[model samples]
Target chain A: MTDVTCFSADCNKSKLFWGLLALGGLVMLSTLSAYFYIEHHGHIVTGMNNQIVWGLPHVFAVFLIVAASGVLNVASIGSVFGKKIYKTRSPLSGLLALTILAGGLAVLVLDLGRSDRIIVAMTHYNFKSIFALNMIFYTGFFAIVGLYLLTLMDRKLKPWSHPVGFLAFLWRLALTTATGSIFGFLVARAGYNSALYAPMFIIYSFAYGLACFLVVQTAMYKWNNIQIDEYVLGRIKNLLAVFVAASLYFTAVLHLTNMYFAKQWDFERFILVEGDTYPMIFWLGQVIVGGIIPLLMIFSPGAAKSPARILIAALLVIVGGHAQMYVTIVGVQAFPLAIFPGYAETSSFFDGVVHPYSPSTLEVMLALGGMATTFLLTTVAVRILKFLPIDKLDQKH
Target chain B: MTASHKPERRDFLKTGAVVAGAAIAPGVLFYGIAQGRAPEEGASSLVRWGMLIDTGKCANGCTACVNACNTENGLSGKTGPQDSQWIRKLNIKHLQTGIEHNLPMLCQHCANPPCVDVCPTGASMKRADGIVLVDRHICIGCRYCMMACPYKARSFVHEPLADQNPDVPRGKGCVEACTFCVQRVDKDQQPACVEACNADGHQAMLFGDLRNPESAIAKAMLAYASVEVRGDLGLNTGVRYQGI
Candidate 1:
């Protein structure tokens, strides 16, 4: 864990890096302990059960996985779209993609009922399953993105970065499609049946990925006492705003389309107005705090000059991203399946009523582990390598 | 290669004994058939096991079938939110008519099971005889199959189990559902639920091979207006309900 190669002549910079690493390591250890405890005690210890099978861990896992694809958007803009300022941020973007995905994937694998048999899960194939396809897409994205990062960093491989970057871009589109389809393809529940999920998640990644990039980049600048230019900052925030608007539009369409059908009316009411945690999260956490406020902050007069306001806006987007995932994953499962239409059913198996869920402390710890893993790995990698973007006044890609 | 050259004696008497013993040894020999099929034999595709449930004959508040299933599967019989219920008695009412019905709900064993289709490791699989089962040996317990099931028939074991029925294998961390009582079915016997229903004089559930036209369940289904639950899903579920 202490294999840091400091780039600066003064060794004093290494002390802070080591201290942050230790803090991350402590959290990582606690996360692993939670994993082991659940593994030994079984899922009975967790709030999850037959109903609400996926809980808080899934929210964190899916958020990170979906955002990981979005994180690569910075690199894609630089290499494939030929944005010179974005080119400066490509390495950091690529690094974030890997470390964040590792964290998300770790939570998913660790939360499995039979995590020890992960090998068998890989060897076994069910091509009809969207989950299986996502596994392949996730693995391929790592390889292509890793290569894309290498090509962008090495002088000799610079010429090939564009082609690799293009491949990575296409692969991520397929990746996000597969990710969204995990819920969309499911017909057992009313909340996930819409085909709009694929495109909606794609736009969400753009917003989430850009917001993540802005937060990390701003923090890096603040940490190093560097002042980011106003023009470059404005351009990036504008892109983020457009994505947020597109994502919001798709979300409205998804709900409106479902509302058009009488069959989906109950589910719509439950999620948007009737249900307890979901409606509040969807309205306050996702829509207001995540969408409107951030858009206002970004487009506000003199906003580009204030880095703190922009950073807060970006942080809010991340918060809203988690809220969106929570409402999508946990909220959907909390509603019981409509097995018998035109019938009010009740049983010991919880057939007709709304399922209850309360996240246990262990479950919360496990969820935080995914974020901690990303932070720990990112901290070490950034310290060891030169990931800072250099923005010249007349930069050319 | 001549038989006469072998040190061990070869005669028609020994060969005759083998031929005669083969006919009678099914129940007696160590390697012979024990329950319908020999140990090495697989579930036959010639049979598509099914059930026909007449809700009119199923009395409300009766839990004989549910009790029988729990006892047969070695379940704790707890009805908590986290408890595993391979089968349950669902009390449903038609909102338009206000007519109520109580039916024992379990795995429908659909010809096209969504659980089987969505399982990442092919652990939620179907036997040749049309019995949907979880191969716990390979099941990684992702629970994706549970989300795909329209019937909500599946249950994931939440706690470590003990003193399980030797014939019915179950474990924590794997998704499970009704197999039409596969162990009893393999032995050419009716499921415990069907037996309990009959013993209770409800005569509600009829189990037989759907592929065979002369089978009692088939004849009954043909003579009656039996329909598959969630038939709109186009699943062609093996379990049919009558008088709903």
Candidate 2:
């Protein structure tokens, strides 16, 4: 005797839902088609080469994965911090974390050269490799979060929610640390070998995930023809602003640390000034569009209260996160390894030169398909389950 | 009736010979081939396979080593950005001095290879004799090793291959690099590039066991100060260069 009243009463909603589902299905189908083509023809068909091994798909995957960890913060706040306002919203947050992870992981796995050998990847273990350790962290996140979700929804399990939520919170911190270390542990690379990357990634997860949470929360409210109370909206927007500020601080610290090292000067110059797309993306896409614009929308007295503006800010944050990931993952790889320090080196393999990469249609399709999957899964979960928060104050307003 | 029949000595001998020959032939063939093809039962830590390239002896525009590497490794020999190259000739000019030098660059075969350390599946590995190689069977084609190599030595197989050397098996989607011609080295033969360099009369490259004081590579190390590229990293690369 679950309450049917919790779900949307409008039968017309199904038609729109079905249409969205079909669109997601189509996108996923195109992704699969691209995967098959890459498999048959090999990586020669793509923009990837010996020099630029990773490209657009990686940016999408890394962004989604980092944001997935962030999405869980909503539930963590509700149960771990004992915020009653957040507790009502915990189910939706849990659902979102799971869906976003699914989407990100899909892109990562499908992009692998031997995607069919997933069973081998699962079974094999090289303890020294951080990537191997991430597999454990990822699987644990799913199990712990699933149990946490159970405690949130089931009446008998409600007592267990706080403890489970506490574990999930700790689990997510470790998960994000592991994700950051994937780049941080690169001892040879000019850009990545930083101990700072782990915490920076955690802060990034917070901002991106909360922004994602806000956007979805807004969409859900709009769809149900409900409006959240101004107080709750104010609280969430403030939290997002704080997270964004912390991320900005971390970004500044990371750059300052890089600049301090004499050897890293060339790399810093390339990223901050010399490189064409990287510098542009860093200043315009990441700092301006992702950071400053969103802060303006969140903090501006007139705009802060509007749901439309908040949603726009969240969207900008997501876009900016992608740009940052591109600069980090691809841009770093594009810069030549300092193999020959004193001399100008030349080779047929594009040594000592910035490698060029253009995203192929297939790669773009795969990335968009990941976003589609996230949307589709989130919509379906909320439609069938009582994930939406019912704010008494909002109803009264 | 067949069981009851008493066989003649000739028939009995003939039956015995056929049965014995069938059983012994395979064993004899296996032992003979295994003796020729198999590495010593264990790669001795006492032996460290290494290379010393004398840049002073290296000649400009000499394609001998590069060509031989391509032929021996079954590489397409195409120097395109997308093509796989196990070894390449590097032309370097000192920025300040304006002095030019030429040398063949390949996997440095570092004692502590970063590529081996970063590989998720233990596919990138170093043999006991210090020859670093990709276990292509286990390589999931993640290309993380490509990122980790300091020398830019490794290459990902971008396209499907044809006419690959059966002795040196490679597949598309796997990252590969200079194996130091392990197939030839195990049999006390020089790597193809070294042999071709010698044949071309440059004798710029010398390959030998570094552990043996009597070996040419060790004696050369004693006579000349050899430098590992990116020597500050303290990788102790087996491949060293004289007169960088």
Candidate 3:
């Protein structure tokens, strides 16, 4: 009788929890409705056409996927590197990795033209194609990471955590490499055919993934009315600063390399100065707001000491991440292909003109639905499972 | 009775000779003429279909070829960014030389096609006859092929389609490009653009089997200095242009 009453009490729901769930549910419903509408009508309703095939959904999908691989870094530091504080946070890290990856994949699959014919994609194999290779990598990551999470969560399986954690770490690096190589392998384009894309994406994943982790950790601590240790915060804050700096360095190198090439000068100029909205997205959004402001807040005087300032910096980095993806994916495509190198060419197919694209309401809703999905999954998982970082772990190590 | 039922060696030899002569006669008469396969036969690798275009012979402002392509394929013929263009005419001016040139551009039909290389499914494909095509049956419409195309030849269908040509199979949500008019080519008819060019008395476009030494296109290519546009990429395009 005592157990029965206790179980009933545990089933009670909080007002905040119910409200959060409702918000996520409403957005997801809209996303489903939009998908059906697009499927029924066709891609003509969307901003994407022949010139700009992928749209807002890809930006959101790619960001979530890169961040998902990076979040596992927390768990890797614990099990693989033998860090004590991060060890206490490993369970939460593994959980976030799984849930966030789910959100990213949902957006990608839903945006396909023949979503009903996904089985054909699974059955067909084109080994030479990088896009085909990525399908294998994504599937492998889910299976390997799921097993890694199981080892971290279960006490009986704890003995195998180290080997599994190391495997997951390598697999995560490979997954991000494949993702970056998707752009890098396009030999026809001026914007993407660089060897640096793989390592640059790896670094971006580190920054974006760590930023996501910090925000969630801070919120969870606040919800429980607990004070987080300053030592852990200080170490992680400095680490985030390193990742942000590395990402910026890579971005600078990518542009400078393009500028150095004689044939690429026109493309570089178009992206940096002449092209509409592209230069603003590159300089203002990526360079200024995302890179410099966040760096200043994290390092200037006593700004780093304040937790709020650090959180704001992380948010800025995320916003900047989106800006960078937009410039990379959409901006690169706006420039016309150099069909005739020495000749000025004109045709009825909008050959020399900058291809225009503007995202529709449905696309925006679909992208936001990805984020809401992550949030909803995280919230419910936290409430049901013991995902909060354990106290008194610093002394144990 | 037994002698009536059994045949002699002389009679058997006479019958064999008649059967041999009857079998070999039609084949000898139609050795090259039967190049076009019957409907039941698949595309054969023995033939490599190609085109040779003489830029000098191309008219300055003729839209006949483009119009015929639209009518043949049931395209809307709209020049908007969303519209599909299987063939287009290009007006080019050299940056340094200030020399002007007019020509028609379509699929290059590269031996090492980038579209076929980048497709996740084996839908963007090259036929046995060396004609590059998209198999719309299994295309997931990712458009990676469009991104990879250097010539800007490919187009993705955006809106739902209607009033399609019976000979051509096309629909929305699939990536498509110039197939060198495979539907007409299969029927032993020249591509609509080539036919229109000839009907206009321009005779700028010639389509034939590149492997056949006697083909007019092959002979013209041998006699004149024709060059593939963007030949530096080493795609070995089947479409070659002269007097550019």
**How far is A169's C-alpha from truth in model 3 (Å)?**
1.3
The fraction of reference A/B contacts recovered in model 3 reads 0.82
Report the Cα lDDT for candidate 3. 0.86
Please write out the lDDT profile of model 1 over residues B1-244, one tens digit for every residue. 6665564455566787899888877647645445358657988899999999999999999999999999999999998877899999999999899999999999999989989988988999999889999998999989999888998899988888899999889988888899889998988899999999999999999999999999998899889999899898899898999998
lDDT of 2 by residue, A1-397 (tens): 8843325556558877887789888888998898899888888888888988888888999899999999999999989987877888899889889999989988888887877777777887687888888888889999999999999999999999999999999999999999999899887789998999999999999999999999989888988899877788888889999998888889989999999999899999999999868999998998999999999889998664688988999999999999889999999998888777878777766777888889889888877767878988987888899998888764322
RMSD per candidate (Å) reads 4.5, 3.9, 5.6
Of the two candidates 1 and 2, the one with more favorable DockQ, higher being better, is 1
> Measured against the native two-chain assembly using Cα atoms, what DockQ does each of the candidate structures obtain, in the order listed?
0.76, 0.72, 0.64
lDDT of each: 0.90, 0.88, 0.86
TM-score between candidate 2 and the true structure: 0.95
Candidate 1: CAPRI quality band: medium
Ranked candidates (DockQ, high to low):
1, 2, 3
- As a TM-score, model 1 comes out at 0.94
Worst 10 residues of 1 chain A by lDDT: A4-13
Best by TM-score: 2
Q: So what's the TM-score on candidate 3? A: 0.90
Alpha-carbon deviation at A84 in model 2, angstroms: 2.2
TM-score, chain A only, candidate 3, equals 0.94
